[model samples]
Target: MSQIVVLDTNVLLHDPQAIFAYPKDEIVIPAIVLEEIDSKKRLADELGRNARSVSRLLDKIKEEGKLHSGIKLPNGSIIRVELNHRNFTQVQDLFGEITNDHRIIAVAMNYHVEQQALPEQERKQVVLVSKDVLMRIKADVLGLPAKDYISDPHLQADDRYNGYFTLHVHPSIIDEFYTYRYLMVHNLGLRHQLNPHEFVILKDELGTTKSALLKVNANATKLEPLFLSNDPVWGITARNAQQRMALELLMNDEIPLVTLTGKAGTGKTLLALAAGLLKVEDEHKYKKLLIARPVVPMGKDIGYLPGEKEEKLRPWMQPIYDNLEYLFDTKKSGDIDKILMGLGSIHVEALTYIRGRSIPGQFIIIDEAQNLTSHEIKTIVSRVGEGSKIVLVGDPEQIDHPYLDSMSNGLTYVVERFKQEGISGHIALEKGERSKLAQLAADLL
Candidate 1:
C-alpha cells in the first residue's frame, strides 16, 4: 500500500528540505500549515529563512503541475497542497481550541478517514509528521499516527557515538605504550576501526590495576600519548582524563575545530574560556577571544529588553560574565566589566550579531550550542576565517530549544559529523566535577 505523510508547519520550518524527505511516499501540506509558514516568513531569523526556503521549494514544484492536485516529483512521490480538509468538528470535543494545531490535526484526520473508507486492499497509511510533542499526543488521542521528522538518522541514544571507549589490553602492551610512547592501532582488536582522533582508556586485561590514556592519530594509524602541557590553562588544571584530553585539543593550534560535551559543572565552559584566554593574552596565538551563545531560553528579540546592545545582553550573558570574573579573580563589583571595557582582545557577543562576518585570527567559543540547529551551527562555523579556531561547548542533554534534543542538536551533530576528520577533536565528559552536591545532583537527580 502507498503512504501519505502529512507534514506540520514546524517540521518544514526546522528543515525546509523535509518536503523531498519522503521520496518514496506521497506528501501533504495542510492549508493551515501554509498559513503558519506565511506568518513566519517575514521575521528576520532562521525561522524566517526556512519559511522563505520552503516557499521557494513549493513554488518550484508548482511549475511541474498544479499543487492543489497531486504533482508527481521526480523521486516517485506525489506532493499535494491539502486545501479541503479544514473541518475541526471531528476533534472539537477532544481538542477544544480551534488553533492552527487543531486545524492541522483535522486535516490529518480527514485524510485518515478517507483512507479508511477505501477497501482494505486499497487503503493507504496516513501518518502526521510534526516536531511538536503536544500535537503528536493529540493525534494519538484522536487515533492518528504521528511521527517526529528525524532529519539526522544517527541521533538515537543507542546509536549515538561517544568518541571514546575503554579497551582491555595486556599489561605488557600498557608497559610498551609507556616505554615506546606509542602503540599499534591493530591492538584495539575491535570489530570495526575507531575514528581518527578518538581517545582510549587502555586497561589491563588481567585486571592488574594497570591502565593508560591514549589518543588515536589522524590517520587511525597508531595510538599516541596525549601531548598535554604540564602547566595549567589560566591557573585551572584538568580534574579527570576527559578534561585533560579536552585541554590537549583546546591548547593545540593544529586543530581548528573542537567540540566538548558534558553535563552541568563538567568544566566545559571554564576550560574553553581558560584556553581562549591563554591563547589570546599569554601566548598571543590569536588576535582576540570571541565568546557567543544563543539567547534561546529568553525570547528571540533583544529589543524587548532595555538599553544598548551590551547592557541589553548583560542579563542573558551573565553565565559568560561569571566565568570571566572567576578567571580574572575580580572581587569588586564591576571589576570585570572595567577590565572588559579596557581590554580589546576579549569580546562577548550575542549569537545574533555574529552572522554575515569574517572572523580571523581569533579564538571563538560558542556556548550552549545544543540549543542551536545544525544549520545555525554551520552558519557560525563557516564564519571562521584564516588563522582562527572555533570551539563549541554544550550539554546536549540540557537543551532549551523546543525542537532540539540531546541527539539532534547541533552540538551532537557536529561531534558525529567531524569525529573522523583530522582538523577536529571531541571529548564526552562523563563525570561531573562541579562539587559534591553538583555531581550528586547530576547523577542521582
Candidate 2:
C-alpha cells in the first residue's frame, strides 16, 4: 500500500531534492514548513542555498498542477500541500503550544486520523520524516509514526572501510612477495574482496613477525609492494603503517582524491600538509599548495567576536597554521608567515570562498572536512579543475555540524563513494602519533 510521508522543514533544508526520494508514495508538505523554509532562504550559508533550491523545486513543481489538490510526480508519487490543516487544537491539547513544530505535528495527526477513518484496506500509512531528534520523539509521544531522513541507507560508522587489512598466509608467500615484488590475489584464497589501492599486511600463518606490506593494484587482481619512502617529508616521517599508507596515496599524482580519517592526535592534517608541500615545492608537480578548512564554530559563530574576516578566521584556522609552522620549523613568532610570503606558493583560505571557482594545477587540502555536508563536499570537489589533487582529512568522531554525524558526514560519504575508483584512495589512521599526553587524552578522556 502507498504511504503518506510528511516532510519537515529541516529535511528540505538538509537535502533540497528529498521530495523525489520516495517513489510511488504520497508526499505531504505542511503549510508551516513552507513558512519556516521561507524564513531561512535569505541566510548566507549552506542552509540558505538548500532553501533556495527547495523554493525553485517547488516553483517548478507548481507548473505541473495545483499543489493544494495534488500533483503527479515524475516517480509516480503524489505531492500535495496541506494548507487546510492549520487548526492546531489537537497539538495545543497535547503540548499546549502553537509553535511551528506543533503545527506540523497537527497536520500529520489530522491526516493520520482521516486515514484511520477509512476502511482498513483503504487506509494508508501516515509517517512524519524529520531530521530533528526531538520532533521525532514528540511524534512518538503522540502515537504518530516518525523516522529520521537518512541520506545514505547502507552506511554505518562501525562498518566503514579501514583502508587496510591483515591476512595471515604461509611464510613462503611473504618470501615470494619480497623476492618478486608482486603476488596474484587469487592465490591468497581470501574470503573478502579487496578494494583498489587497499593495503594488506601479510603475516606468517604461524603468527610470527615475518610480514610484508602490500597494496592491491587498481585491477584488484594483483598485490604490489608499497611505495615506502625513507626520506623525511618536511622533517616528518611516517610513524606507523597507516601513516605510510596515507603518504603513499597523498604523494601519488595518479590518485586525484585522498581521504584521511582518524582521531584527534592521529596526524591526519600533518601528513596531508607535508605531502602537499612535497608535491608543490619539491616536485613542482602543481602550481601551488592550497589549504582550506570549514569554518565551523565549536559553540557559537565566530562572527559574534569583534574583528575583520582574517581576524575572525585566525582562531578557526590556527590549527592549520600550527601544522605549517611545525613543517617550516619556524623558531620566531613571524617566521612561518615570512616563509609563506617568500615562497608565495601556499594559500590558506576559508572553504566559503572556494565555491564556483575552478581550482587548477594545485594541491588542495580540506581540513576538518567531517563538518561539511555531502552537498557541500560535492560543491568543493566539483571546483577541482585539471591537474589538481584534493585531500579531505578529518576525524569523523569529532564533527561539529549539527546535522552531520560519523556515518553521514561528507568525509565518510566521499570515502565510501570513491573507494572503488582507481583515482581515489582512503586511509583511516588508527594510531595517535602525537605526544603521549595527547594520545592518552584521546583514548581515555
Candidate 3:
C-alpha cells in the first residue's frame, strides 16, 4: 500500500532534502509548513540556508507539475502541497488551540479520515513525520500516526567506537610483538572486526599485567606498535592509553581526518591543540594552525555584548585561548598575546566564516564540533585543500545545540561514517583529566 508521509516544518529546516527521503511513499507538504519555511528564510544561520534550499526545491518541483494536484517525483512517488485542510475541529477540541503544529496535524488528520473513508483494500496509510517530540505527541493524541523523521542511523553511547580495545592473547604473542614491533592480524585470535587506525591493548590470556599497545594498519591487515613519544608536546603528555592513541592519530600526517569524542575534562581539546602545535610550529608540517568552532550559545547569544566581531567572538573562543595560554606558559596576563604575535602561525576564527574558502597547508582544529549539524561538517571537511589535516574534537554528551543530540550531532556522524576510511581515525576518550572536581561532576552529577 502507498503511504502518505506528511513532513513537518522542523524536518524541512533540519534537512531540505527530506522531501526526497521517502522515495517509495507519497510526500505531503501542508501549506502551513511552506509559510513557516518562508518566515525563516530571511534569518542568517544554518536554518535560513536550509529554508532557502527547500524553497528552491519547491520552486523546481512546481515547474514539473501543479503542486496542488498530485505530481510524480523522480522515485515514482507522488508529492502534493496540501492547501485544503481547513477543518480543525478535532485538533482544536483536543489541544484547545489552532496553532501551527495543530494545523499541520489537522492536515494529517484530514488525510487519515479520507483514507479511512475509502475501501480497506484501496486505502492508503497516513503517517505524520516530524522532528519535534511534542508535535508528534499531539498528533498521536488526535488519533494520527506520527514518528520522528530520522535520516541517519543512531549509535548508542556505549556502542560508539572507543579507539582502543583490550584483546586477550597468549603471553608469547605479546613477547613476539615487543621484539618484532609488528604482529600478524591472524595471530591475535580476534573475534571482532577492527577498523583502520584502531588501537588495541594486547594482554596475556593468563590475565597477567603483561600487555602491549598496538595499532591496526590502514588496510586492517597487520598490527604495528604505537608510536610512543618520549618528549612532550608543549607541556602536555598522554596520561592514558586512549590519550596516547589519540596523540598518535593526531600527529600522523597520513591521516587527513581525526575525530575525538569524550565527556568534559577528558583532555580532548588539550591533546588536539598539543598535537596541532607540534605539527605546525615545531615540525612545520603545515603553514599554520587554524582553529574554528561553532558559536553555539550556552544560555543566550552574545550579540548584545559591547564589541565588534572579535569582541563578540572572545567569549566563545576563550576556552581555546585558555589552552593556548597554558601551552605557551604565559606567566603574565598579556604574555600569551605577545607569544601569539611573535609566532604568527596560528589563526583562531569562528566556523561561520569558514565557508567558501579552500584551506591548504594548514592544521585545522574544530572544537565543540558536536554543536554542528552533519551538513555543516560536510561543508567544513570539503574545504580542506592539499597538504592539510583537520581534527574534530567534541563531547557528544555535552552538546549545546537545541536541535542536536549525542547521536545526531556532527561529531558522532563523522566518527561513524569515517571509521572505515584509511585516511581517517577516531578515538572516544574514557577518562577525564581536567580536574578532580570537574571529573566527579561529569561522572556523579
Candidate 4:
C-alpha cells in the first residue's frame, strides 16, 4: 500500500520545499496548517521567510489544479489540502486544548480512520511528519504514526565526522613522515580516503609511542606538517592538539570556510575571536572583523527590559562581550567597548539583520551557528562576497533551537556537506579549557 504523509506547519516552516520530499507518496497539508503558515508570514524572522516561501510555492503549484481535491506534481506524488478531515472529535480527548496541534492531528486521525475502513490492500498508512517532539508523542498516544523531518539520515550522533582520525601504520611510515616534512597520500596506503584539510595523527601500529600531527593539503594528495599551527593569536594559545588543528585552519587564508564544533567551555568562541582579531587588526588581511550570533534565549524572554536595539541585544550578546573583555584582559570597566569603538573595524551585529548584506573583504565569524537552520545558514553564507571568508563556530550538542538537534542543526549539516570540499575545513575539539568544574559539568551533568 502507498502512504499518505500529513505535514504540520512546522514542517513546512522548517523546509519550505518539503512538499516534494516524498516523491512516491501522497502529501496532505491540513487546512489548519495553512492558517498557521499565514499567521507566521509576518514574523520578520527565519520562520516568517519560510512561511512566505511556502506560500509562494503553494501558489505556483495550485495553478496546475485545485489543491483541495488533488494536484498532480511532476514528481509522481499527489498533493492536496485537507479541509474536510479536520474532525476535532477524532483527537479532542487525546489532547485537552483545542490548539492548532490538536486540529492538525484531527486531520491526520480522520484520514487514518477512513483508510482503516477500506480493504487492507487499499488502505494507505497515514503518517504525521513534524519537528515537534511533544506533538509526535501526542499523535502516538492517539494511535497515529509520526516521525521527524530528517533530510539526511547519516547525521546521527555516532556517524558524525570528527574532522580527524588516527591512522595506525608501521613504525617506518611514522619515521618516513618525520624524515620528510610531507608524505604522499598514496604512500600512506590508507584504507579510507582522507578529506581535504582533514587532520590526522599518524601513529605506529605497534605498541610503540610514535605519532605525528599532520593535515591533508588542499589537493588531498599529501599530508603536510602544521605550518601556522602553534602561533598565538592575540595572546591566546591552543592548549591541546585539536585546538592546534583548529588554529591551523583558522590561520589558513586559502581555506575560505571553517567549522569548529565542541562542547561548552571548549574555547570555540575564544579561538575564533582571537583569530579574527589577528587577521583584521594585526595582519590587516581584511577590511574589518564581523561577528554575528543568533539571539536565542536560554530560559525566558527579556522583552520587558527597556532599551534600543543595542541595549535590547545586550543580554543575548553578553557572552560575546565577555569573551572580548577577557581577550583584551581589561583592568577597567567598559574598556573593551572603548577598544572596539576605537578599532572602527570590528562590528558585532545581531544575526537577525544579516539579510540582504553583501559582505566583502572581511573576516566573518558566526558564533552559535547551531541554532540556525540549514536554509538560514545558506542565506548567511551566500552573502559572502569576493575576498571574504566565513568561520562557523558552534557546539552542536548545545543547540537551543526548538526544531534543531545535534544531528540536524545547520552546524553539523555544514560540517558534513563541506567535509570533502576543498575550500572548507572542520575540527571537533573535545577538551574544555574553561575550568575543571565546567568540563566536569559538560561531561557528567
Candidate 5:
C-alpha cells in the first residue's frame, strides 16, 4: 500500500527534489512549506539556493495540473499542495502560534487524523518526514507519526571507515620494522583484520619493549610492508605485519587525491598539511604547494567587507594562516606570508578564482571542503592538471551548507564515489591530537 508522506519546510530546504524521491507514495507539500521556501528564496547561500530550486520545481510540476488539486509525478505518485482548513484551529490550540512550523504540524496532524477515521485496513499510513530533530519531536507530541528524512544513500555512522585496521604485535617487531619494512608472520599464527591504511602498535610481550608503529600498505603486491619510518608521521607508525600495508598506501604516489575526514581536533587538516609540506618542500616532488578553502560565514556574513580581495578573504583564511604559522613555527604573520610568497613554488589562491584555471604539477590542499556543493567540488577537481595531487579535508558531521548533510556534502560524495578508483585514497582519522578538552568536546558535546 502506498503511504501518505507530508514533507516539512526543512525537507524542501535540504533537498529541493525531495517531492519526487518517494516513488509510488503520495507526497504532500504543506502550504506552510511553500510559505517558508518563499520567505527564504530572497536570502543568499545554500538555503536560498534550495528555496529557489524548490520554487522552480514546483512551478514546473504545475504545468501538469493545478497544484491545489494534485499532480501525478513521472513515477505515477500523486503530489499535492495542501490548502488551509479547520486543521489550523486544532493546531493553534495545541501549538498556540501561527508560526510556519506550527502550520506544518497542523497539516500532518489533520492528515493523520483523517487517516485514522477510515478503517485501519483501508487507510494509508500518514508519515511526517523532516530533517529537523525538534520538528520530528513536535510531530510525535501532536499524535502524528514522524521520522528524520534520510534521503542521501551514502550516509553511514560516524565510525564508518573502509580502509582501516587494528593490530597488536610484540615490541620485538621493531627489528622487523626497520629491516623488512613488512612481516608476513606466517609461523606466528596470528590473524588480525586490517584496513588499507590502518596502523598497528606492537609491544614486546616478554620485556618492556617500546611500542613500534606499523602501517598496512594499501597496495603492497610485492611483499608485506614491515619497515618502520625512522620517525612516525601523522602519529601512525608501521610495525609488525601491517607496516608494509600502511606504507604502500601512504607513500604511493600513484594516488593523486587523499582525503582525511574527522571531527574537530582529529588531525585531518594538520596531517594533510604536514604530508603536503613533506612532499612539496622537503621531497621537492611537486612543483608548487597551494592551499584553499571555502569562505563560509560562521553564523552570518559581515556583508561586504570594504577592502581588497585578499582583505575580504582574510577572515575565512585566518584558520589556514594559523595552521601555516604553527606548521612553520613562524612568530610573525608577515614572516610566514613572506616565506610563502618568496617560495614562488607555493601559491595560496581563493577557491572563487580556481574555476577556469588549470593547476598542474602542484600539491593542493583544500581545507574545510565540506561547505562546497558537489558542483563546486567537481569544478575544483577538474581544474587539476596532470601530475597534480589534491587533498580535500573536512568533517562531515560539522557541515554548514543548508542543502547538504553528512552524506550529501561534497566531501562525503567525493570519498564515496572515488573509493574504488585506483588513483584516490581516503583516511578517517579517529584520534584527537589537539587537546584533552577538544577531544572530550568532540566526543561528548
Candidate 6:
C-alpha cells in the first residue's frame, strides 16, 4: 500500500530529492517548508546546496502543473504543495502556534485527518517524515504518525572490526617465537580465511607454552613484523589498544576504508598521512597519494577566500602540511612542499572537484568525512575506479552537520554497513596517540 508522506523542512534541506526517496508514494510539501528553504538559500556549504537543489526540484515540478493542485512525478508518484485552508485549524488546535515546524506539522495533520475519513484500509497510510527528532516527537504529540528519514537502513555496530584473532598451533610452536626468526605455519596453508588486516596471537597446543602476534595480508601471506614501531616515527605511536588496532588497519593495504574516532590531537590525520606516504612513496602500491577534506565550516563558508587554487587550499590543507613537515623532519615549510613536488606522484586536492571524476590506481584519503551527508559520501565513494583504494577517516562524535548525529555520520554509517563485507574493512580508533597531554585530555575532558 502506498503511503501519504508530508516532508518537513529538515528532510527537504537534508535531501532535496526526498520527494523521490519514497517511491510509489504520495509526497506532500507544506507551504512552510518553502519559507524555511528561502531563509536558508543564501547560506553556504551543504545546506546552501540543498536549498538551491530544492528550489530547482520544485521549479522542475512546477512545469507539470499548478503546485497547489497536484503533479505526477516521473517515478509514478504524486506530489503536491499544501496551501493554507480550513483544515489548518485542526493543526492550530493541536500545536497552538504558527511556528514554521508546527505549520508543516499542520499540513501533515490535515492530511491524516483527511485519511481518517477514507475507508478503513486506507486510513492507516499517512505519515509525517522529518529529519528533526524534535519535530517527529511533536508530530506524535499531535496524534499524527511520524518517522525520521531513513538515511542508512543497514547499520551494525556489534559486527565492526575488533582487530584480534586466535591461531591454534602445535605445542612445539612455543620454541618458534624465541628460537626461530619466523614461523611458516604450512599446516594453515593457503585459502585460510584470515582477512587482509587481521592479526593473530599464535598459542601453543596446550594454550600456555608461548604466544606471538602475526598479521595476514590479502594475498594470504603472513608477516610477523615487530609488534610496535621502534623508532616512533613522527612522534606518534599506538598508545592504547584501540589506537594499536587503528595503526594495524592504517598500515595494511587490504583494508580500504579505515574509520578513526577520537577527540582532537588523537594523531588520526598524522597516522593516516604517514601510512599513505609509506604505501605511495615507499611501497609503490598506487600511482599517487591523494588527500582531501571537506571544506565545510561549522555554520558557514569563509565567504571569499583569497588567492589562487593552491593558495586558497593552504588554510585548510595547512594542517596536512604541518603533519608532513613533522613526519619528514623538515625545518622549513617549503622543504615539505619541495619534497612533495619531488615526489611528483603525490597530490593534495579539495573535495569540491572530486565529484563525477573517476580516480583509479590511487590511494585516496578523505579526512573529516563526518561532515558529509550520506548522499554526498555516496557520490565521493562511487568515483573510486578500478585498482583504487579509498580511506574515509573521521570522528563521528564531532559532527558539524545539523541533521547528522554520530550514528548517521558518513564515517560511522560506512563503518557499520561495510564491516561485514570481506572486501571492505573498518576500525574505530578510540585512543589518542598525539601526546601525553592530548591522551589525557581525550580521556579526562
Judging by lDDT against the true structure, name the best candidate: 2
Give the runs in model 6 whose Cα sits over 4 Å from its true position. 1-4, 16-27, 34-81, 84-99, 110-127, 137-147, 154-236, 254-257, 331-345, 385-387, 440-445
Show where candidate 2 strays beyond 4 Å.
Answer: 87-90, 116-119, 299-305
TM-score for each prediction?
Answer: 0.96, 0.92, 0.92, 0.94, 0.80, 0.70
Q: What Cα-based lDDT does every candidate model obtain?
A: 0.89, 0.90, 0.89, 0.90, 0.73, 0.74
Q: What's the C-alpha lDDT at position 316 in model 2?
A: 82
Which structure is stronger by TM-score: 2 or 6?
A: 2
TM accuracy, model 5: 0.80
Question: What is the model-wide C-alpha lDDT for candidate 3?
Answer: 0.89
Cα lDDT tens digits for candidate 2, 1-445: 8999999999999888899988999999998889999999999888999899999999999999999999999999999988997777777988996888998999999899999999999999999999888999999998999998878767665789899988888999999999999999999888888888999988899978999899988878999997756567777899899999999898888889999999988999999999999889988999999999998887778778678998888788889999999998889987888899999999999898787899999999999999999989999999999999999999999978877778778998899998888888899998999889989999999
**In model 6, which range of ten residues has the least summed lDDT?**
225-234
What would you estimate as the lDDT of candidate 6?
0.74
- Candidate 5: stretches off by over 4 Å: 39-44, 167-251, 302-306, 355-357
- lDDT tens readout by residue for model 4, 1-445: 5699999888898888899988878999999899989999999778899899999999999999899999989999999998886568857765667998898888898899999999998999999999999989999998999999887854568888989998888999888888988899998767888999999998888988989999998889999999984757899999999999998999999999999999999999999999999999999999999989988877765565678888888878888999999999989988988999998999988888776799999999999999999988888989998999899999888888877877778998899999999999999999999999999999999
> What is candidate 5's local distance difference test score?
0.73
Which digits, one per residue and each the tens of the lDDT, describe model 1 over residues 329-445? 999989998998898889999898898789999999999999999999998898899999999999988988877777778888898889889999998888888798999999889
- Backbone clashes, each candidate: 0, 0, 0, 0, 26, 0
Show the lowest summed lDDT stretch of 10 residues, model 1: 297-306
Residue-level lDDT of model 6, residues 86-144, one tens digit each, is 35576677667677777787778877887889989757477999878889898888888
User: Could you tell me the lDDT of residue 181 within candidate 6?
Assistant: 49
- Model 5 Cα lDDT, one tens digit per residue, 224-342: 44343436553443332322332344455777877777789876666666667777877888988888888777665635776888777878777777777788789875898898877
